[model samples]
Each structure stands twice: as structure tokens, then as C-alpha cells.
Target: MSRFTTQLAAGLLLAPALLAASAVQAHETGDIIVRAGVVAVDPQENSGNVYVGGANTGLEVGVDSNTQLGITGTFMLTDHLGVGVLGATPFKHDIQLKGVGRFASIKHLPPTVTLQYYPMDKSSVLQPFVGAGLNYTTFFSEDLSSAAEGLGFSDLSLDDSWGYALEAGLDYKLTEQVYLNATVWYADIETTATFRTASVPSKVDVEINPMIYMASVGYKF
Candidate 1:
């Protein structure tokens, strides 16, 4: 978690100012642009009120951020329009229970496909764009901590989620075929979790709305 925090802080400090950099060239129609960089996932989670033994109980849930290798590919259908796909190495998040401590962890993959529109023409040096898309998140490898295990927590699982994604980005042309890119994305994700305790099964709803950030060098072909 500390490592993730450090990386995210570093990116926050570096990217925004660079977004205003001047461009030298821009991509054209029929071009394929590929980019690679470090990506961060910061979850803004809101948990449902937990109920046990048929009685309402208060519980708080939180998620820690993670950074991973990020990659994206965009295919230009026209000088001003493109289709893009975003991907990354799986992200793992630590799930902490308020007052109770870190109780579990989960891994997930969010793949998104978006339609992007560039405001500048191919002759311009700077390209600023906006995009909208669909995001599908799949969760796996859910595990309970030793403390949770001791408390009879087992068979933990989380349901998959499908949601909408929105994005904005800037590309500063470095050369005719290369550029620097910075992008930010938001996704709506909500899921339900279920687990077994010594006495009975328990459930809770978790909303993991996340903000994702990326900065990468891109190549056009």
C-alpha cells in the first residue's frame, strides 16, 4: 500500500504541468498508436451497512490503491476519430475494515473500450481528446487474512461488475511518430461480496468507483 501511494504521488506531481507542453506533430488517419506506462487504480469505496443475526450492524470498508504496468492501443478511423482499448497487469487491492483492520484482499482486471475524439487536426502538435466507453471488471483470487480466518471467515468471493467509463487525455508530439501521453479515467463499479463464518453466511454490497491515471510514451505506426 505504501508503494502504491508513493507511485501515485509521484505521478500526481509530474503529469498535470506537462499537459500544457507544446506539440511538434500529430497522428494521421489509418495510424495505430500504442503506449506503455505505469498506471494507478485508486478506489473510492462505499460499503453497505452489514447485517448479521438479522440485526443491523455498522461496518466501514476501504480499499487501498495499486500501481501496475499499463498499456493502450488506439486505431484511428479518421483524422479526428479513433477507437481505443485500455489494459493493464492485474491490480490487487487491500481491503481494510474500519476499527477491525485489514481483513481481506482481492485482485481484478478492468478492460475498457472507448471512442475517442481529437480536437486538433493532424498538422497540429498538441492533441487533446475526450472519450466515453464501457468497462467490465472481473474479480478473482479473493482471500481472507489470518485474523479473518481465525474469526471463521472463509470462502470469500466478490461478484463481477460492468459499468461506464469516461476519459480525457493529452498528447504532446515529440516527433512525427512518437509522443508523450497523459490520461485520466473514471469508472462506476459496484459488487456484492459473500463469505462464510462459523455460524452462517454473510453478505455486503461494495461500490468501488475508481479513478485511474496513466502517463506513457506512445509510438504511431
Candidate 2:
């Protein structure tokens, strides 16, 4: 056979393989779907700040109880496997050290993407999922004693932190567009903040309870 004919025949033999692979990928994609859910967060960080105040300054501040509206997108990779993206607004709050004329809050946005596996069908009324992932916490917009009158402005000590994530959740499908979900996840979000006006910088070895009671209504095609 001529060289051109030989190449043409080889391509013909390979065409079926390529077509099969494409079909497999397409099936995987169709089996896979994206699910978005609402995430509400409440976090408590420990710290103390100091400002020059004589006698006493109610430098009293409270724990940062922040409830945020966040979203999570999920994709099913297989009948028993899935992957997802969990994103949320940056969390912010202030701390008031009693008797000290100083207060501050650490702020950050935590965006996490995880690979999950489920043992139930999408059409199943109840589906549960477990996953592992990486968590990136970016701290920003840190401010001090904004509510504390006469409290001079000082710098905040927060740095970007990275950690591992372990998650487990259950999805109860009420309907295709409405489902109830509950998830509990743990992350090692240990970060250090150096208060410029305090005795020293504080290192926070805090575990963000990404663990939340989740309930959401999702859509499927």
C-alpha cells in the first residue's frame, strides 16, 4: 500500500477508540451534576488588645459570631463519587479585652474545593456524602476598635493560612428542586495575628468549624 493509504488506514482503526473515549467522558459529565447549597458560619477566635486608657476603658468586646451566606457547587463524577466547590464571603468580627482599651477583629474568606463520594443515587430520597479537600483562608480588612470611642487606630495581625479539610454530609431530597442537607466538616485553620499595639503577636491555633447544619434546595437536569 502507498504511504498515504497506510496512514489513512491507521486513522480509521484509531477513530473508534477516540469516539469511545469521548462517549465515556460525555456520559461521565451527564452523570455528573452541580449542586449549590447555602453555608452559614459562626466562629469564635480568642485574643486580647491594649490601648492607652487610664482608670478603666470598657475595652470590653465580644466574640465574633458571624453568620455568612455562602454557596457550594457539587458535581457527581460517578455513581458513587462526586467533587465540589465550597465558597463563602470573608468572615469578620471584633474582640474586646475587658479592662483594656483595645479591640480588634480578624477577617478572611475561606474557599475550599473537595473531592467527594456518595453511596446513593441522585434520584434517591436520601443521599450521604463524605469528602476530603484543601482549605485556603485569606485574611483581610482587619480593623481595630472601630466601635470603641477614642480608641486610636492600630494595625491588625493576620496572615493567609492553609490547612486540610475532612467533611461528611447527608442530603435528603424532598424533590428535584428542594432538598434538606446537613454537613459536619473539620479544618485545621491555625493562624497567627500580630497586634501592633499589643504586648506581642498572637498565634491562633483555632479549628474553624466548617461543621454546620446544612439545609438547601438544589436543582438537577
Task: Assess the local accuracy of residue 1 in candidate 1 as a C-alpha lDDT between 0 and 100.
Answer: 62
Candidate 1, lDDT over the whole model = 0.88
> How close to the true structure is residue 128 of candidate 2, measured as C-alpha lDDT?
80
What is the C-alpha local distance difference test score of each model?
0.88, 0.59
Q: List the residue pairs that clash in candidate 1.
A: none
* Distance from true location, Cα of 118 in model 2, Å: 0.6
Clashing pairs in 2: 61-96, 157-193, 157-194, 181-214
Which candidate has the top score in TM-score?
Answer: 1
Candidate 2 ranges with C-alpha deviation above 4 Å? 1-38, 44-63, 98-102, 121-123, 146-153, 198-210
